[model samples]
Target chain A: MSENKKSVFNEIIRPALVLTVITLVTALCLALTNAGTKEVIKANAEKELLRSKQEILPAAEAFSEEKEEELNGKTFKYIEGTDASGEIVGYIFQNSTPGYNGPVTALVAIDTEGKIVDVNALDLNETPNVGMLVGERDFLDQFAGHSGEIALTKEKAAENEVQAVTGATISSAAFLNSVNEGLAQYAAVSGNAPEPLSPEEQACPDAAEFSEEKTVEKDGNTYTYKEALGEDGSLIAYIIRTESKGYHAPVIVLTAIDPDGTIQGTATVDLQETPNLGSKIGEEEFMQQFVGKSSEISLGTLSDTSVEAVSNATISSKAFVDAVNQALELFPLVSGGAS
Target chain B: MSTDKAKVKEVFTRGLIRENPIFRLVLGMCSSLAVSTTLIGALGMSVSVLVVLICSNIVISLLRNFIPNTVRIPAYITVIAGFVTIVQMVIKAFFPEIDGLLGIYLPLIVVNCIILGRAEAFANKNGVLISALDGLSMGLGYTIAMISIAFIRELLGSGTLFGVQVIPASIPPIMLFALPAGGFLVLGILMAVCNRIAEHFGQPKAELGCDSCAAYGRCPAKEFEASQDEAQTDADRKIRKAGARAKRNEEDRK
Candidate 1:
């Protein structure tokens, strides 16, 4: 009789019974936890959102949800920032734009005067130092105090344009585009043109004042190339000066382009980079590789090119390439003068 | 009482170093490799595993008597998943940053071999309190291994500790240390160092590969038996060949 009972328990009931019991108990535990945490989670999310809203619009004491619009299946949220006395200070618009690897969402705040108060990059999955450089204070600050239809350029950022992050131009462009979308939405509702760049910050540093130079248009802006005279008073080679943002600081390279469009020499005008790593870019062996290469040498880790980047200093290497490419673009225009 | 104390101590200490889940046992390596990129990520993952492991062990040990051998695996899996779900909900609600960092790996802990292996090999056979103790020790061991690897990766990859800049500005961080390849390289070197240390202590370095692994007891293939059978057959063939050679020699003499 006992064996018969055991067989029944073993054959049919036990497996189903045990699994059912375990699943029910688990479900009970999870339900209890969910009950306790649900409200706290909601509150935490709201609190975080409010805190970020206040952070970009510091002048405003409170904010009101203005309106939201759906474009291309993405929600663009806009809020009206009000002062302590309940006066409208600025409008904060949140938008997400697809970046190099992923979508980067940004908060762009424009005051009543239509000038940008501040721009903050919120949720972003870009690579930490490469694409996420948009989070840097200096990079974000470039957007503040600017107005009008936002444009991103690699050139020295004039009043109307923002400079792209070196080696992360795509991400920078994406970040700028997200902000531009926010501004565009704000304009669509209010029908106000974006304020132009302020006059005080309009003058870009004069590259031509240093020497006799020839200006040529490359991607969008004019870059200057000058002739370097040897001790005998004859033209040695054309010098193209360009700057690249490195891991620590901007690396400026002056490349000498020969008449045949080959690189003659390269010199580091300014490089306050990390020692043993970014400093490798300035090493004789690394810079010498660019000397005989054509001005059009493609620069990347995977690309088949004559120049190889330093082992751990890929950012610095790319920056060096950008500076070299700037010089290359100047080569064809000045090839006649050098010859 | 003294022998009992010794046995308990042995169980606990074995997990801490002798059978570290990540380095010594090489279990739960998928999460370890993915989440050790940052110190906080490692800590969050370790805590999640700890919660699931302890809870599952206690439940399994308590239900050991009624659970039929035929349904043991499924029962253990349900218990583990229950705990894992609880952990996931708690983390998502309270520690959302960690939830984001761990991503799907937090849920994937249900399938981590260590938790189920313990349920089958240790928890089901042990008393509830002892099973819980075993789970805690194993989780701690895994946590320590994760922190050690993460410490190096975070420092070298981002030049930061706990997301703070501790390395001086002069040192350029090696980006490779933050990538997936760095995880594998660091894990390998750490395993080798641990083996060396274990050998130094006269604990024969843990047996290599899955055949001798403790987890293999639960493996459906019964791989350990197959390996044993292969060895026995090889031995039997050698003995038979020896007998044939001896017989040939005797016949020649005759």
Candidate 2:
């Protein structure tokens, strides 16, 4: 009986013993390799943050964080930048305000004399075309060198006045509010009060003329007090609305044309399309194609001539064309036949 | 064949293919799925499995003489866990990324049925040399299977195989293949395909002829054969004795 048991051990138990040894050896080698590659990964993350800061404040040679303070019941950071001789070059103030979607944050650069330098949208969670108007260079450039109370309107009542991007009324308002908030904080820290608004500057011309007491009728579209004021205001430079069955949903665009017919601003204030792929229509490149085009230009002709769809993003491109056509139709009415 | 050199060579060759751990024995499927997402990850997992397998097998085989039959499984587990902890600490200090990726799966190798199964069954009864060979082959077989699956999934899903793009830009790469669903789908297809290939190649089934074998009895196989032989002889004697008794009864009646 004992002899029989010995053979069983040789056949069954022996092979199992061999497998265990192989597993143990392999595990030891793997553990060694894993211990070698950790630092490289951490360094890569730090490099990315520095690159983003450089992109936004490219001119400033150096950057330093300022003390945190409360304004309008919200916390903000005042980041100061300096030149080679220790002179203050400019200041990057971080400010946030409630936007259409959520809080929008911006790094507003102000010169030593309290004049606006530039503004970079650090983090914004808002509708693409509607809320993105604040990022436009033309809209933000209006704030440069401005010191007094500012309001967004088409009328040139003061040098500090900023023209709102048409069709993105809410986003424009948010931008004005954040700029005001930033200036207010700067004043409180520097122990000075911001310059008061003048009589003409205080009243929004478009809002005053389009008051609730009066209404206007044009081409079967009823224009009310505020809505009519939006048209009369320089903010509503050009408005166009186009429709095409080619799109999955209706594409509506309201483009603000500068006096020279260049697309100073644009907003896809209304659109329901696929996320990411189709939604890229809200991107800069897509909007840049319309920058210099006139409101009268037919999108159908442009589709064959100028505007081209991004590769693999056909649905979004067609939707953009549809919205562009709609904007073109409303141009004469919104611009008061100026175009 | 009688020399020590010949015995070691025979043992080493058996693990390479004839008794492959993954293909033939079908063991260690947990880490096989978890770390096979990338080739580098698979390589790391393979090395770890090999180290643990070889060390535990060698230790268990050496201690086979002293281990009691009833307490053997517990003893084997303790040895395997010790090596795994050492590997884990060394990895955490040196390679944090891979260490982070492997995470809990590394220590889980201690309970992996393949490791403990081997220690309890083979190493406990075999010589150290044979046990080590078994560990090497099984580990290699598992590694090969894991990398192959990862390669196919990464290529189809991301247009990259092992992080290098293989597909052209014109083709819309299928993203779903990199997800968790793709892992199971790829593994299932690979397993079925392996079985089909084995069948087509006419490989001998490992579990055949166990019944009536001596290995099932005292020797497991020896007693099984002995029982069969005894039954046959008893039947033969009965047939002859019955015939003789019938003939004698016929003579008496006449």
Candidate 3:
């Protein structure tokens, strides 16, 4: 009888004992680690939230707890940004709007006077390097100054306009909708409608006059470049207008170069690059890479991750690079003859 | 006493060179390739993998005698997966930065062949101390392989080592090494180098396969075992109940 009981214990009780001990050991270790790190994890999460809020509203030294409210049809979470004295300097609105593939999220900030403080894109899940360029600083930073109606444009921006990322009109429109939603939300909560930019606040706000225009035919295309002077009659910029053959047809571009040889900006007069094989060259994101560049642009980049040849549109991409290089070369001639 | 100590030393040392998990056994190539794009990511992955490997090895070795041969692999994987999850949580809590660097590799560690292979081959048959040594030895070998691959990848591909740039920006870092294609190229050449060095030292070639499976010749014996399971007296039923519990753990694994 005792022998039978011993056999049962060996078969069942001992095996259960070993497994139980192993489970208990693992559980205890995990529990201890969880307990030890609980406070630090909570603190890190809070720190991250405050940091994100502060990033969009740099005028504020701290941020209040998030509070949500409905505006229009969408819901938005807002945090009150406080200065050293604890006065609400601005409101940081956390908002999202559906884009091409996913929701575009942004932290849009507005101050007491209804001017945009800054914008921090929290997430952008569009096409890589193309639609995703909406999250790029050069693009989001376009929303930093203006408030009220923001319109997307391919031509030179007026005071109330923002350039859309090239090859990503849908994503750009979605991002614009997200920021416009934030502005509207600010107006609803603050009960003040911010005014749009004035006519004097155009892209070249200091421009006084355009120089005599000249055209040069180069590489199977015609280049028309001119100089613009400041209000004080000093050489302000060189606006170079040219056309190059894209994969499908010929497209025109107008680029503004600072007299110092740095590109102020590039505007597509017309673009026929994307929807087939996208040469994102005419997009604001690609042109933004050349905004401060003085050297002749090339197809493959050595240093910049922001600069890339648009895949499947290598020919169109090379054509755009050559066009930009041609403008950079023409900048010298325009400035030398500026009077 | 001296012979026992020598045996222990040999078991540990052989994993480092003669049967390195990456270069010798050719295990865990997927992870080693993916995470080796950056030194910090590779180091983070190796450390996390090392933690799970050592913990699971010890636990499995301790429970070795109680587990039935047919249910052993399932039991081992359950324990390994549980530890892998806990390690990821711990990394998230303590070193969230390294946790981010680890990215998908944290979950991928659960499926790493080296961890399961070592448990099946060595730990299940070995003593507790020897099993722990095998885990440590195998883990260190993995670490060596990861760091070497990462060092080349990061330095040449991104012009950085451990996230610090040592190469001048004027010299373009080869972007190929940063991509998956470059990973295989580097892994192949390095494996060849490690092989040559091992040959120079007269290390015996590692025999690779599933020969160490406890149920190696028993694939066709499943029906026989089930019949035996039924015909046995009351004691066998109790053991079968434990095997059922092992199946439940296997379900939890998915």
lDDT string for model 2 (B1-254, tens) is 56877767655654444444554455677776666666777777777888888988988898798665655676677678877776666666556556756877898888877788678657888988889876776666666677777787767866776667689857866655665677778887876566555545454443446542211322335566689889989998999899899999999999
Please rank every candidate by TM-score, starting with the best.
Answer: 1, 3, 2
- Model 3 agreement with the true structure over A150-185: per-residue lDDT tens digits: 999977778989999988898888888878888888
Q: lDDT tens digits, residues A1-339, model 2?
A: 998999787666765564455445546655565455345445544555445455545666777766777665667677767777767676666667777777766666667667777666655545433466578676777777777467878565366678877666677777777877777777755557545432222222222232222233467865322222354454433333344443467655545443444454455644566777766776666766676666444333344336757567787777676656555555545555433
- Evaluated at residue B197, the lDDT of candidate 3 is 73
Runs in model 2 deviating more than 4 A are: A1-339, B2-18, B196-254
lDDT tens digits, residue span B21-85, model 3: 99877899989998898899999999988899998899889888877665577677778888887
lDDT of 2 at A18: 48
CA lDDT scores, all candidates in order: 0.81, 0.63, 0.77
Give me the runs in candidate 3 sitting further than 4 Å from their true place: A1-21, A95-105, A121-143, A146-188, A192-339, B170-172, B203-254
- The digit string of per-residue lDDT tens for model 1 on A150-228 reads 8988889987799988888888988998888877776754666445422111111111222476666767877666665
lDDT of 1 by residue, B189-232 (tens): 99889877767766654565565443455565677679998999
- For residue B9, give model 3's deviation from the true position in Å: 3.7
* Docking quality category of candidate 2 according to DockQ thresholds: incorrect
RMSD for each model, in Å, please?
Answer: 16.7, 18.2, 19.9
TM-score of chain B of 1: 0.87
Reference A-B contact fraction recovered by candidate 1: 0.69
TM-score of chain A as modeled in candidate 3 = 0.50
